[model samples]
Target: MAEEKESAEAMISEIHKQITDAFDVFDHEFNKTVDVREVGTIIRSLSCCPSEGELHDLLAEIEEEEPTGYIRFEKFLPTMTKVLMERRYRPIPEDVLLQAFEVLDQEKKGHLEPEELTKYMSEEGEPFTQEEMEEMLSAAVDPDKNVILYKDYVGMMTVEDN
Candidate 1:
């Protein structure tokens, strides 16, 4: 039985490897055909996410792509998904409070919803209270919540701010 289990694991790994190889080829080729603006958004999304799953889902939602088929970056997701996927707590950007808030505002709106603001923290199954979410959203308490103008969105994540 142990031998059987080992063999099964080996087969699964091999299959996964093949799938990943193929996905890279497809992603590369398809990227060449996408519009510059679209590509820019996708790249921007990836810059914020720890994994590709978050990138994929958010991009898919933005583009209205059906997420049911072909989640290539199944293991790689954003901060929220990563928390749930790994089942552990990880420290996020601490000192760079302003930049963290800006990126969390995927839509570039004035402020983030409590749920959106807290998703990354709660992604590991740690739900946030209304007060916690409000704290994160209040610019007076945390300057990160200050509304980011469209002009400010482009350079929000640079280390130069530090």
Candidate 2:
């Protein structure tokens, strides 16, 4: 079950990335004004990864005329920490994710911004596509934002748990 969920999330993240990339082509760096064809080509991106910030960032970028490159977070990240801590999947120290959340949250408000979430995303932009980006996030970006919280820094977490 966990594996399947992770796989799906990953798929979604991949699709989301693609969409963001397409958005960037015309919005971020382009000479001509925005067009519908460019926009139409990006709907296919899915959200396989669990990074809510990325989705928010992409959506915000689309909404704005200027390039923001990121989005703000709500109360979801700390929430994801809790979900990830649930032992049903495979319990871990929880501290690792919590610590990460703290650093990312910065303000200690239990939320993260889109730029903060980028650390978890893949740095390599190879094989980029809206569909592909969506696929990666489905597993990576927990939309509910309840994975890790309320603990010190942990050394590691089982892949199965993640």
Candidate 3:
């Protein structure tokens, strides 16, 4: 039991370090604080996949606490740590991602053209915003082919199980 507790603590310590490092990059003023407006960027940089609504809610909560429009590291740490530990930002499973791509690959081509991806991502249910679509395409698209090799994209979206 103690061993489990210690391991969990170690994992949390590592997460905290990563979050702090990410936060530091945006805390340019050396005040251990960041502008409220930059919180989304910072969170994304940390690889926490909160939905747009979830992010908005989180920012609303932060604004309620730090009305000065700046967030101190101390204030950010625990909340972020909780979100991380709870796996609220867990990556999508590989199989699920693959299935989504399969649906998009209606012609059974094992790939999708950039324009096709853009249309679906922008027009489908729970559509991605332009910035979100661009970010995804930047990582998932093969510039040479002008296509998304969906298997490769799924690999990028999911972490390998140890």
Best by TM-score: 3
Give residue 71's lDDT in candidate 2 (0 to 100).
22
Task: Write the candidate numbers in order of decreasing lDDT.
Answer: 3, 1, 2
Candidate 2, RMSD to the unseen true structure: 17.4
Candidate 3, residues 1-162, lDDT tens digits: the string is 999999999999999999999999999999999998899889877777677789888877656453888888887888888888787766667898899889988999999998999999889877998898999999989989988999988887776532
In order, the Cα lDDT scores of the candidates are 0.44, 0.41, 0.85
Clash pairs, candidate 1, are: 51-77, 52-76, 53-76, 54-77
- Model 1, residue 71: C-alpha shift (Å): 5.2
For all candidates, the clash counts are: 4, 71, 0
Candidate number of the best lDDT: 3
Q: Model 1 scores what on Cα lDDT?
A: 0.44
TM-score of each: 0.22, 0.24, 0.81
Evaluation by lDDT, superior candidate among 1 and 3 = 3
Report the C-alpha lDDT of model 1 over 10-65, residue by residue, as the tens digit: 86565455434433444654532333234324333323323435544544543424
| Better model by TM-score: candidate 2 vs candidate 3 | 3
lDDT of 1 at 151: 29
- Give candidate 1 regions above 4 Å deviation: 29-72, 75-162
